[model samples]
Target chain A: MGQRLIARRQSLKYLGMLAGSVAGREFLAAWLPKSEKAEPIRPTESSYTPLFFEPEEFSAVEALTELIIPTDQSPGAKQAQVARYIDFLVSAASEYNPALQHEWTDGLQLLDRLSREKYQRSFHEISAREKQMLLEEMSLPEQDSGRTHPGYKFYRLLKEMTVEGFYTSQVGLIQVLEYKGLSALSEFPGCTHPEHQS
Target chain B: MGTHAAYDVIVVGSGAAGGIAAYVLTMKGLKVLCLEAGRMLDPSRDFFTHKFPYEWPYRGEGKPGQYGKLPQGMEWKIKEWTDHLYTIPAEDPYALAPGSKFTWTRLRAVGGRTNLWGRGCDRFGPLDFKPKSLQDGWGEDWPISYEDVEPYYDRVEQLIGVSGSSEEVYNTPSGKHLLPAFNPRCGEVLIRKGAVKLGIKVTPKPLAVLSRIYDNRPPCHYCGACNWGCDVGARYSSLDVLVPKLSRQKNFELRTNAPVHTILMDRSTGKARGVTYIDTRNGLEYEAYGKAVVLAASLVESIRILMNSRDREYPSGLANSSGTMGHYLMEHVAFNSIEGFFPQLAGRPTSNDDGPGESCLYIPRYNYGEKDRKYLRGWRFDFYTGCGMGPGPGARFPGFGSAYKKKIKELYPAAVQMGGYGEGLPFYWNYVEIDPGGLRDRFEIPQVRFHTTSEYDHAFAIRDEMYGQMEEILKASGAEIFPYEKESPYPLGSVTHEAGGCRMGNDSRTSVLDEWNRCHDVKNVLVVDAGCFVSHPEKQITHTIMALAYRASHHLAEEFRRGDV
Candidate 1:
């Protein structure tokens, strides 16, 4: 695929030379020299130290994100280091609004309290099955009776951030989701399905 | 204050209008100096196109609460992925009237907002030129007709390399394009058929992005990051296309980081001598002399400069003799959108759908000839698919774990959306003025306070009609549409198609600029941005802004030759 792209680019360069106006060719010479092939992205080992969450809270976050997107048929959130990304984001956000950091910290405490009440252990000490059950309960909508769970809103926020971090990561997009875009295409082959065209 | 080198013409704000004005004037052998408020950017170095989210600190999801603290002017800049293309909010600020809200999306770079534009280049038809007089009496008609600007449009379209297919729609005037149109996606093909079944005309969207290698610029590589700045110059931008060509000329000179404070006037002759500007780098003031001064500093910014140009002869403002300098503000008001999931394409594999940000299918103003509608003016519909590559509403799905991931994958390729860009009538109540309550920019110039009244009964009515049409089309396409009740029109100026602060007309009492975009009070000063728009059509205003700038500059050059100044 890389070789094909390079060949396509070279042909485009030839075509541009043939059809380009004198002024267009001049501007092209000035701007097109840096159009070299981009470097391939390699997975780097993360040396992230938790800035926002405590050590216990960071462990719970890692376990929770893994459960949310476990290593099933494809690589998941744990491989993407979603928890570390979330910590980095929240830590930087403290300068803009410290309330966000407080909310995250308090939410972690709430999860721990719920785990202690249900299974006589901290959230990080709980088993994966128990953690999944607790998360399921938290995902339940508020009933018509107006009774709400304690960690429901926090679950929603954590889930949103985890999804954002995971899907945007190289592991989730390139490996799990198989997102194939942002590359040079000679032409967009749009709408191959004939049935779609009535 | 030291005086800089003088030129025959000094064009302010090196955006679309200023760039085109400088290009046309300098091509005619007149010495020109272009003043830009922001610094220059090398797109290959500055644009974040094709960069993965992992490359960013927050993985493209900006830092939490960072957006909340940003000023209203910097809302668009809060996106960490493309923040480099925007101006710093603290350096340039504007105010809103009490109980009013407006989003003045601006870029202070050499290319202005062109660096971050959607690149949907559409032409205004004869009806759009005089919608009030021809169709309904919502506002004053443009003094110049479509025929007067048609030739200039042809020239500009060929120069910029617009890619589009001709259609039979009368409201959207056809132009000669340099390349053929982009092919429609599967979802767009479905929607086009549905639109055709409903007797709605769907034509190829005219885009400033290149289809073939027109000029020396390479064709689009389908990166889908046009808004982040086109690194390859596949899309049209003043910095890449116009400025570089003109900068090569010996007669042309460009001064970046020079924000014009006011248009300097010779009091005795009652003509614009040049301009006084601040060198933003060193905090020093300087003056550049010119025979003519063209103000293309955007709509609101240009008006702010004119309002700040207060003197003994023109106390209210430099061009405020009509007392209508900042009156009749307008923007495309109705932006109603609807999205749905198609079952047939639900599990289809994703390809290189990352073309230009613009879609292939465009539904022109269909209600132009209809007289029995609830609204006075009309709206255009743009159907698109695979335009958004990021996580969508699926990210907000209930629950988590592997089932959640499966649901997102299923819904990803099935997504399709249609949005409307409707016309807004110019109103006296929706105007901008220098804030008297003492809010100022970094340069200590008083910031503009915008006020938009709720005179949008017609706009709301058109939105309802748009929703009904969207529902019919989505239903016909065999898709499960999102609930219509949840959708609402965006606020005023949210579309960033604001116009009509310094409107052009034949009568000086009702307009700030004459028919040729020249100030009736200050003859040598011309406002060439969208500020000179008389009526805000639903179409994108950049094409008309460029065409009008070319037309006005042509006349200015002729007038100079004739010694009219």
Candidate 2:
């Protein structure tokens, strides 16, 4: 019984270390019950047209941003319209910093190349399991600062834009995170918890 | 130019000093004309205090290339919200010397930087007046004392509507006109509890906020947007608190967009009888004459005006009889900052914790009377532990995907920030002068150039010690310390609390201004701003500037009654 408890504690420590990455999610899947993976939510068509990316490139960007901040318990990047925000940001960059626009275009093509090289499919045509694995592979160089591979650079840029676009949206800021600032109050009631007072 | 030649007094720059001079002088029934370098801001249109990130066109991140609008030497932080107050580069051009590194945060408008100030109204103690008498004897003592300025401080506080606790804190005077200070936030209480173990007293910051319905203004509703311009008259900006009432005085007149070019000197009397200024709207130069002229166009700008007013009688600069018009420049040492969070409060339910920004909690200078310290002057801390739960931390956090989002949500109410602001000894070499290269602004005025340094090792040592103590206090509260810069890496003028150019002295041979903030050389000219500050204190100086302006204007009023001018 002592030996089993020691082994369980070791596994728990490893689980905590890799819990946020793809590695621990797979580990948990083997033991814990597998949850349902719903169909990916696509943003509703509107009057908005892609200013920077082409029609097919926009679809791939939309798929990736939604994947980065997937809908689990609340609305994700799809509902936040993160892909449209990126297009707006990059398109506006065309006037002053054209290199920024080039980087986004090159980054999307690199992701497509990585998807085709590994899974024999385009980035938007990949399976959900294959997509997650590709993302996991692309993010390997991000863990090490010295590695400046093309895949790492592309993944970093896309992930950053995705985070910025999603978190600043009303759906993410107010509904998901429920930000507590930018409101009026008659009086501020500070830490009411007795244990926190010390 | 209506009644321009018949004014009793001409006050330049409608900011803290000029606003007070106009208010007090007009109350004394003197004809006062206030010349503002910038346009009159409509608070309903210009202020964006309650604006949300989603409401902003750029989502509060600022547009991609919009930062290029700020002039060289201007602060980058102003480009987002308060950029309208700062001057554009080519229009109001000022040069930085080849090796000099400074960020002069100049603001023009009826209210000046008061519209975007921290509003921490700390009064200098009795010791602050006689700094030269201290242990190391590094700087000169002010000709005026705390006793001489105490009554004026009281009046200014009452007039501006300050709110803070009346505490018997050392080396600090308890305010006589302060309203009730706000209740301590949770982070403040926790930090105070932690500081108790270290023998440091964390007190509620005395702020220029109306805590109650005082002087017909409604109380502050705690929006935590003080830096973004207070639209409601709850927070004290000179525009909201002083300008409206002063304008109602029949003896007063205000001219906006009228940037003063120089002090029009009377060669025979050797006194300033009028001012030459340019009206920005019509692009015309006009002369407005008065019995007396008050140079309250901020500290550096006042020096620029006096320097530009040079003639054959006093070629060095207009009141350069003592040769110290723009010498001892000092800014508060403020690069020592530590961001941390209490572990016990992590994952807790978030609340609207941003009660009063910048005026939350302060660890007052604890080394008031200590002689055994390694540093000459002491430092203080400004800590704000608001629940700034936003996308900002998520961007800074490592990783992405569902887990990253979950972590950000969990650590929502756990962020805290503490920074130390301390005194930097005035080195004689640090100064501001007219650019010898002869670059001029759009109005054909010689541009002011700055020369200063921040590589003061002794001052930086104190900044490092401040960071260490902050870590100790937070660790005592079971808080986790985030990574931060240990060394003092900020430039000299990062604080923008520049003081000391025309030093006030009892003697005329060593200083430009007399004890009453009047020019020792020119009898009718008064430099009534921080330009006459003898030494820079660790605390901010806007409160002191207002008080000194009040004292000087009252003394000028008495002289007017006596027919001395």
Candidate 3:
């Protein structure tokens, strides 16, 4: 039985190596940087403070971004370094779009107030499934106040940023979906997939 | 003045054509001074290393009225449309009566629109240049034919590093391509299959974007932020190849933010003496003279400079003896089509992170031959497969809630659509006349009055036929069509692919410049831009424009050597 267990472990290890050789190596090569090269994400911190939200409320926003794009199959919002990006973007809010920054901050506080009234836990502490359910519930056009319910409007902003951040990131592009032709790929099949045929 | 300060040639606009002209001229042992109206922006400092559209000061757009177009929420994308290009405003924005709204987009910074352009480097065949003989009375023939430009085109394809296959039978001229053409992703492959099933000849197009390492430039990183600038020095922009090379030359001096106001002409001789321009930063005026002056400052601005000269010899304008200073403006009439929930995209996470919308395949003009069609001219079609579903004005129409998200996921992958890039006829009515009422920009400079797309009906008919062809492909693909309103605005120069403002011709009476783009009246002044294009060929004009600049400057050097200038 111990020998059988060791053999099983060996098989698993071989499979992992094979998988890594085929796809993981290319992915890791893209993910890992050489010593000479600079990191895609810069080290400078963002100047955009959470305008309407307190420190606690801003944490909820960060958590919410992660929840929407979880770090599972690929680098989610957190791994793609989206929070840093959002911070850099928000700090320069007065210059780009003031209303957008206000809406983002206000939405966080409103969501926290609504959450406190319902389940009694902070948004970040909530279960993943529960958070997803709440998001799904509030994502309605009727719930959007356009101005009054800032949280509802803020949810929309989060959605835009989540999708934008995910799709634009290297992990979301290559890992989630196979996007091979940065420079021409050797053997790209142009719309000839048998399953794709109408 | 001695030949101490001034160079043998003074080239305006450090964009694609101007950069190439400077490189060629400087390489030929002539000193060249290249002036750019915008600031000299470095890519490392100005572009990339930022996130979100709101990270920019102008929100990635240029300063208002800098483009001279009207202000609208939709126009915000005009700024993000290109990093180096400026959005030319439509102060006296002309409409196509009730139905037409055109987008004339331009880049005004260091590299110009080549930074934002799709990099679809298509060639003009013998038919496009000699259109008058091929299909007479529709449009005039190019002053020179494809054969004349063929050698230069081959040379440019080599220097710039064009990648593609040569199906020598098509309208696009075959060449000795530097690299093999890029193949489409799986989604694009599906579209190609559908097109083939529909009898559409869709092939991988020759693109300026590199597939392999060529000309010492790196291959594309596939970052997909192509409409923004390339940070990796992959795409063929002036910054990557031309300007950097030109900067290395001891004879070349490029000064940016100097907006040329007028051409300084010798009153008695009626010759172009120099140019008077305002420094955009300091707002101070400076005059720079040269033995020969080449105007590569686009179609409209190039002509506007000459008109503002207002010399005594030619009262109407400097080179107004032909009475064709600003005539025959043309833009590509892009007819777009969209459909949702493609079957192929179902349950698949596809990578939409590719280069800009420069398509892999092109549906060559089908109605070019002697066929019974309502439209006089033919239009080309290009298709793109996009990923990511957005919740905007079109969000509610598709559906709502979780189903919508699921539908979006399903639809995003399957979403492949085609658009018609139709040709606009060069009519005398659709022209740019100077604003006599003295309408000024935000910089308080006088704005140009462009009256374009007068022949909208003719242009629309051609577009409609192309749309019908798209419908046929969709049907052949067996994709379920989600219907939307076909209410696009008229060809209002929105794309900023502005051409034919100062047309080239053999006859000086009907055109602004001669075959060499030389002002018929002025011996030393040469215009090398869309201003010199008599007809707008089906292909993008940048390559042709650069080639012309090279040819024109080469001619100027030979002339100067022969004591002609």
Best by DockQ: 2
Residue pairs with backbone overlap in model 1: none
lDDT of each residue in B468-545, candidate 3, tens digit only: 777778767655444433534245465555688677888888887877779887868888987887777667667788
- Residue B24's lDDT in candidate 1: 88
Is candidate 2 or 3 superior in TM-score? 2
Error of 3 at B357 (Å): 6.6
Give the lDDT of residue B296 in candidate 1: 96
| lDDT tens digits, residue span B466-537, model 2 | 788778888876666555546553566667678888989999988999999999989799999888888877
The local lDDT score (0 to 100) that residue A115 gets in candidate 1 is 94
Cα lDDT computed for each candidate against the true fold:
0.75, 0.75, 0.61
Residue-wise C-alpha lDDT for candidate 3, range A1-198, written one tens digit per residue: 001000111111121121123233442233222322111211222454654445565555566666555554345556665565555556555553666577766676677666666678756566655555566455533222232333445665676555554444565444543444344333433444566544
Task: Name the top TM-score candidate.
Answer: 1
Q: Where does candidate 1 chain B have its weakest 10-residue lDDT segment?
A: B387-396
Model 1 residue runs over 4 Å out of place are A1-49, A142-147, B1-5, B67-78, B88-91, B453-455, B484-488
Q: DockQ-based ranking, best first?
A: 2, 1, 3
Q: By DockQ thresholds, what CAPRI class is model 1?
A: incorrect
Which residue ranges in model 2 land beyond 4 Å of their true spot?
Answer: A1-47, A116-122, A138-148, B1-5, B69-76, B88-91, B369-374, B392-395
**DockQ of every candidate structure:** 0.19, 0.21, 0.08
TM-score, candidate 1, is 0.91
Q: What TM-score, computed on C-alpha atoms, does each candidate reach?
A: 0.91, 0.90, 0.75
